[model samples]
Target: MFKNKKFECYLLKNRIPGVVLAVLMTVFMLMMAGRFELFNRLDSKTYRTLNEIESISNPYGSDVKITVDRADYLGYDYFVDSERQGSYYICQQDGRYAILLLKSNDDVVLNYTIKGRMISGGSEYSSIIDGITSDMGIAVAQLETRMYPLIISEVDFPRIYYNMMLLVLIVTVLWSVYVIVRCIYEVSCPWKVRSVRDVLGKRADRQTIRDIDSQLRYEMYYDQYGIAITDKYFVCHGMWHTDVVALDNIETFKKLRTSSNIGSGKKKIYKLLMVDVDGVTYEQDFRSEKDINEALSYLSDDKRVKR
Candidate 1:
């Protein structure tokens, strides 16, 4: 089976896309699995103190509790939208200064536990704090040196991130399974001579089978799809079906050119359109104009193929 050029070509053409997709999905699955394991191992329940924020390693995903006994609102609030907002504050806990971001809501409290993930502050937040400190006539250097200022949100960011990754991983697994199954079906169960003859309503005879087997040896064009021209028949090997038409039954054959915009330029697509005497049309795509032209040249000698 591997030595036959037609079967080998068909196998590779149908299997390569699925194999590539499965490999990519497998890589993504491994990466997501590692991330999920990391998140599962993190300490999400125990709340760390503000003083330990800088000292603790991998504080980005760890839960932290900020006791806001003395908070100076900087009069600046960050708004993602109308529904979501965070107010910045400069808090003092046991002479240690740290930045706190409280989710905007009714019934403000001066003393409460602000619990959430300890996320590093971005440069934009630093710039905003710089302006706030300047307006209040306070030096930024006055803040504690042991613990740098960081943002603390009320939202459970770690849980949300883990859920999003899980959703993507599930989708990738499903797609990988579908591609693998399709590739297996295409390669394992190809269209045999009997199958092609049945599709074309040919009689069950040794001569008919022999003719198809002989024609398959010399494919005019073979890729994901194929077309074979013999002395008396035109055999088309489609992705999911095989069709054989007698040369006398073919009424018309024409080349079609279409152009479509791709980015900043146009890409041309070439196809061969075949119409039988019964007005049944079959269209096959060609990778290039030269390939379509070559296929057309093979049928130019036949009087039945009207071009």
Candidate 2:
């Protein structure tokens, strides 16, 4: 029933559109919070130890190739040369090097990163210079009006969970409630049948009882309201009824006194019966016990059946 409950909540979670949405919001969240950014950040944090540094020349290019003491450089090497190189250029900062040459193999090879320990020391360190590639005659400009640094901030919310979507969900819930209540009301009124046989038999067991169950529906309905019965089974809604038992049908009479019993144990073949003023043998296989009893009591002679 609440199949979409978890989904709906998840959509609005994390103050979306920060958590806004993707094809699979759950997948995106589990991925990195903001899509693949989560995994990307984690992988970025994982790096090979800096170890000792070394200098080497590619000899093929005018650039001087700087190597690291370790083997697992994560497939990256640095360059240190002021002259324009054959392919790429690299420079040093905070003990790490940055790459220039927008199309340089060095840029692709060297996995430059922002190290926290590098910046925390003091303002003697520069933010942009601390970034990779900024030292190679390259620079990044920032908005000056912002007094404090915006980096390392977790912000942005509400944009993801929109109001229109919420309104639609509310309307859907209301529709469901209305559907459920209407079904309940339909259930409150137990349906009934008018079996010429159940009330009486070929002999009508008692003709008086037969007349009661045989009463016109409206006449029977008014009297049956507010009645509580536990023993009888209600078949289908009265809008549809079954074939009625004939007034003098012998087989029908035999069916009436079955093993099935209410006030007492008796043999019976259970079937819902219905009555229609416009049809003969109004008794049908789909009547509610309410109607059957109403019809029976309608014809009560002992005055035992009451409105």
Candidate 3:
């Protein structure tokens, strides 16, 4: 199941082995349904055990026989007919006697027909499986004249598995929801919301810049949305940039100044004020993305800005 939203955070990815375990479990399940080579031989005892439930209708009727893929060890070629009864016989590698049948049921929930099959092949294989059924009196391939819907009726009510399944499904859904919600919060909430007044009051800790180095030059590098970090001499216009802006940063102010300057790129430099997009001041003058973040971080935490 794919989600519409991509979990954009940098998380450890597909390289993990968790996916491998999930795949192995899925394959193990398919094999349990007799899909693996080891279980092809369906002896009478096995058939009787499965038949006891009676509620699950093999969408494949008794008429269809399965195409025996392997018959070396199983010792039986098996099949089911139109009426939902099964039959088995020996396998001949020559392929002369191999036949398969399939049937499907119109299950309402899926809006499509679903099917299953019984196989017939391999004489040696058939002998081994049917040999167990010899005294059962009921042919393993004999179709039941009557079919019953799967339901539960105990002294009090129905099978608890049904309720359990519903409960499990609901829990899985809730768990998924919780995971997604947390992921969203983890990704988005740390990016605090800044208001216009918050933006105006925002300032960078100039002390950090001054303390870092004495011979620094300052340049304002900006676009409609971003700033580039370079030592001081202040290029009012940066040549190339591609990113969006966080409103409360000193770098955003720098980009704002750059955009409002006279010439493009290296040609112009000026005193930058707030950027007015649709009559609202949105940006500033500073050097680095770090500076931009400092201002945004301040407003995000400042109760005055929030108010």
Candidate 4:
């Protein structure tokens, strides 16, 4: 597929834009990686603290303060001691104190106050850890609870950074796949142009460009294609099909200059025969000026041409 000259030309024409986009995407992915690494470390630190608390017999009395690392406030296992002491909830006063209400086995509510504040996870606010500490004199046997401070950070789960990187990756993969598929399709597409009578037949309209006006439409190109001019219309033969432009529809005709620098540093100019149909422009370039004039002469009577 890569050996095909037309596909090679297509790649050459689009290489600059493709490279520029790839570079931009790489930079953005790098930035996202940095953010994930930083926040991931922060979250891991808090999780390690929780692991440490599990080994301690009296975690609630410890001076070590830790914060919630995840976006949700209920980061630590809320039901860690649920089987022993039932369920617990925070009191809703000024929201400064962690007034935990424990529902006892006897259906009695036991209130325990702890010191803490609310923490935010970027957007939503959570009271996950902040600065919670249980009442100092509470017997461990009576409560069977760990009262260590859960100090958590407000920043959690870098969604914007990760989501943008994911989107870019998906787009890049899809675009690369599309380019490959399109190249394959184009390489396989067949093109042919017989005589006007053979292709268009005698019943088709064969008016010259000068006979039509702004309502006429056509398509033409120079790369990897050939031009055939009949008395009725000029046909641009491509891999798929041909576009016929009547001479009567040609509102304007001129030379369109184009250049390419595929080999070495030498600039090569192309002589493009530009024609207008309706408000749209169609153009085809030849290797030399003589060829362009000859192609135009086949479509129009006054073949002096314009530059």
lDDT, candidate 1, at 98: 67
Best by lDDT: 1
Residues 1-307 of candidate 4 have per-residue lDDT tens digits of 4332332233333444554566566666657657656334323323233455346564432322333222212223223345432223432222232222222222222332222222322211133333232334544343323332333222222335545666766677567656555544433332212322233334233232222111222232222246655443555555433455555556667766566876887564656554555455666667766677565554444553565
lDDT string for model 2 (1-307, tens) is 3232321122122122222233234343344334534333322332243222112122111112223231111122223375432232333334544323222333233443322111121231233334422434443333222111211101111212323444544555555555445334322211221232343334333333233234322123332322211112111122222122332221111112124565676534433222323332322321354554454542343422222
User: What is the TM-score (0 to 1) of candidate 4?
Assistant: 0.35
What value does the lDDT take at residue 107 in candidate 1? 35
Model 1: per-residue Cα lDDT over 276-300, one tens digit each: 7888776777879888887787767
Candidate models: Cα lDDT each: 0.63, 0.29, 0.31, 0.41
Stronger candidate by lDDT (1 vs 4)? 1
Better of 1 and 3 by TM-score: 1
How many residue pairs clash (N, CA or C atoms closer than 3 angstroms) in each of the candidate models, in the order given? 0, 34, 43, 17
Best-to-worst order by lDDT is 1, 4, 3, 2
Ten contiguous residues minimizing lDDT sum, candidate 4 = 208-217
Instruction: State TM-scores per candidate.
Output: 0.48, 0.21, 0.19, 0.35
Least well predicted 10-residue stretch by lDDT in candidate 3: 147-156
What is the clash tally of candidate 4? 17
Q: Please give the distance, in angstroms, between residue 176's alpha carbon in candidate 4 and its true position after superposition.
A: 4.7
